[model samples]
Target: MHIHFIAIGGAVMHNLAISLAEQGHQVSGSDDQIVEPSKARLKKANLLPEQVGWFPEKITEDIDAVILGMHADINNPELVEAQRLGIRIYSFPEFIHEFCVNKTRVVIAGTYGKTTIMSMVMHVLKTLDRAFDYVIGAQLEGFDSLVKLTATSKIILIEGDEYYASPVDHRSKFHLFDPNISLISGVEWNDSRTNISKEDYVNLFETFIETIVPKGTLIYNKESTILREIVEQTFDCKINRHGYKMPEYSINKGVTYLHDGDYRIPLQVFGKFNLSNIAGAYTLCEWLGVKRDDFYKAIASFKSSIRYLEFVASVNGSVVYQDFLFSPYKLRTSIHAVKEQFPCQGLVTIMELNPYDVINENFLPQYASSMDESDHAVVLVNKESIKDKNIVLDDLEQDIKRVFKHKDFVFLTDLDALEGYLESFKSLGFNLLFMVSPKHNTMNIVSFADKFFKNF
Candidate 1:
């Protein structure tokens, strides 16, 4: 089979291209820009495009299929050529579903904890010698690729998201995946980029509920009132619903332990959201034929993904940690988790907001009291992000101050000012918690951590 990717430099697209190429298919791709890891990985797989720009000649009649990435525009030349040639086009999800239609599909979806939960499931399965293919958003430890598809695997675990599948396909990505086993971590609308109202966002999950295969299983976070109501009100759907919450756990000396009767299991990952994710993963694995004891044993050694509460450096009692937390709910929970783990130290949190949140007026109220747990909170608002978005910096800062209940709040837009602020904390001996996301142009967090904590 011959396959071509329109925008192959995407995080998932490049991985999928390599996987398919390795599977004995002739895979080719084109992208305007390709970055470090993707470029290196694709080169290793012998799948990197010879040229960066798209060429209509590459989209030939011999191509069996063209997989379109979300990064590509609707008017992409390659996509236009594919359409003109009457070639079958697929979104990555659609192509994934094509190969996984006969397999047992498990799709994990929700507002939060999707990546952690899916990673836990993948970790336990791999430990137990289970043969399965998967598509996850994060790069977990020991996993070589973020996307995997094989003919022999009987089960496929996918990290499903409620975002547009592609520029051409307006359907939500999760809607394309009809899962035999589904899990919804929880539903809290915070995606201002989608420009959808709260009710409309919730409706996406309600529609996703309808997509579950009949008589299949659904594992959900019952703690979410909105999600629970949506599951209950969907009268036409036929599925077995299993609701899970945070399991019994305790933090001792900064280590988390899960309790089961008289046996106590120590975990490398901490936080209530993670504990809940473990519970959901355990439930799903149980249905997949893993015994409770075996699942617990394998999961005891499971570590958090690199971007989740990852330890960076430790100096005496003060430590620096990095996390990919930006949403209001996640921000509040992560702040509390770090503070709870180290009750004796003062936590100084540096949070960077996404550009979508900077322009949206409705997102400010949701951030109220989100950073209350941190002793000192710094919010980085990139000045360039608000350039054409019609945002007033002074008004935005004042509104943030008014809404957020942090007593020691600092609104900083300059990276130099942020560095100086962080330097001032060195003498104060406060633990640093960096909550950042991708596309953060304000500061290079990992570099800063290494240079600042070099001696520590």
Candidate 2:
């Protein structure tokens, strides 16, 4: 098969193009701009375009399929050329669906915990030597690429994102999978560039429920009240619905252990929220016929990576932690977890107010009181981040103040100032937690944080 990709420089797109090349397909692609990792990986596979930017001349009649990427718009030159030739075009999700048309599709869906839960299921299945295909949103510890495909595997696990599948396809990516086995880790009202309302957001999942293959299994988070209610209201006897809550556990010396009767299994992950994700993953594993004992052993080796409570450094008794927390609930859970995990250390938290919702002044109030668990908290807001959204610092501060209402809470705009403030904390002997998203395009957080830890 001959496949051509548009905007092939994307992290996942490059991997998919490489996968196709390695699968013995003749692959070629073009992108307006290509960066490190993606650029290097594409070149290594000899799939890199000799020149950047789309060329209508490359879209000849012989190409089998053209894969469109999120980076390409509806009027993209390559996309337009492919359509002119009447070639089959596949959005990222569409390609996956076509590849696994006969396989049992297992999609992990939610506004939260989807990636981690999907990672858990993939890790355990791989440990059990199960042959399966997978598509995840993030780079994990053991996975070679965010996507995998095979001719013989009967199962394909995907992180079902609710975002737009492509510039031309407004349908939610999860809506494209039509999974035989599905898990909705949790659901929360969220805003998107489309300005989708709360009702519209919830309705997407309701639609997702109806798309499950007949007699399919849905394992959901019982602890999330909104998600639980959504599942109950839909009550379908045709599809099996199982509710999973947090697993019973105890923490010892800052390490979390999931208790399985007489055995206390230590884990590389911490917190009650992660335990809840494990429960959701466990239920999925059970549905797949993995033995209970093997599940435990596999989960024991699972270590979460950066932005999921990844320990950065320990300067004296004070440690630094980082996470990719985007939602209010996730931020609160992480803040509380850090405090609980290191009760003896003075907890200080640093967070970036730069997500789409955070930059929108109207939604800023949703985070009120969320970070009160931290003894001293800093909220970093980039003026440039909110500029495009028309959000001002004063209004954002007021919204944050309304929610946090903390005596020691402080807000800063300059990245250098924020780093200086953190550096001043070195002598305070407190555990510093970075409850931030990696979306801060201008700053390299790891390198910046390294300076503080080394100075201490």
Question: In terms of lDDT, which candidate is strongest?
Answer: 1
Clashes of 1: 0
Tell me the tens digit of each residue's lDDT in model 2 across 1-456: 999999999988998899888889999899999998898889888998999988989998999999999999899888998998899999999999989999999999988788888888888998999989888888987887988888889999988988889998899999999899999988877663336888888889888888898899888988887887788778864799888888888888877889878989999888877788889999999999998999999999887763578778775677777887667777898888888887887787888876576756566777788888888888887776667676667977777777779879898877888778766656345787887765554455676566566556
lDDT of 1 by residue, 1-456 (tens): 999999899999999999998899999999999998999999999888888998989999999999999889999999999999999999989999998999999999988789988999999999999999999887888998999999999999999998899998999999999999999999876566457998889899999989999999889998999998888888678889899888888888878899878868999888887888899999999989999999999999998876788777776677778887647778888899999888987888988888777666787788898999999898998777667777888998998889886899999887777777766555345688889875554677766665455433
Candidate 1: Cα lDDT at 199: 86
RMSD of each: 2.5, 2.6
State residue 318's C-alpha deviation in candidate 1, in Å. 2.2
Please provide TM-scores, in order, for all candidate models, with all chains considered together. 0.91, 0.91
Q: Which residue segments of model 1 deviate by more than 4 Å? A: 191-193, 384-399, 426-429, 438-441, 450-456
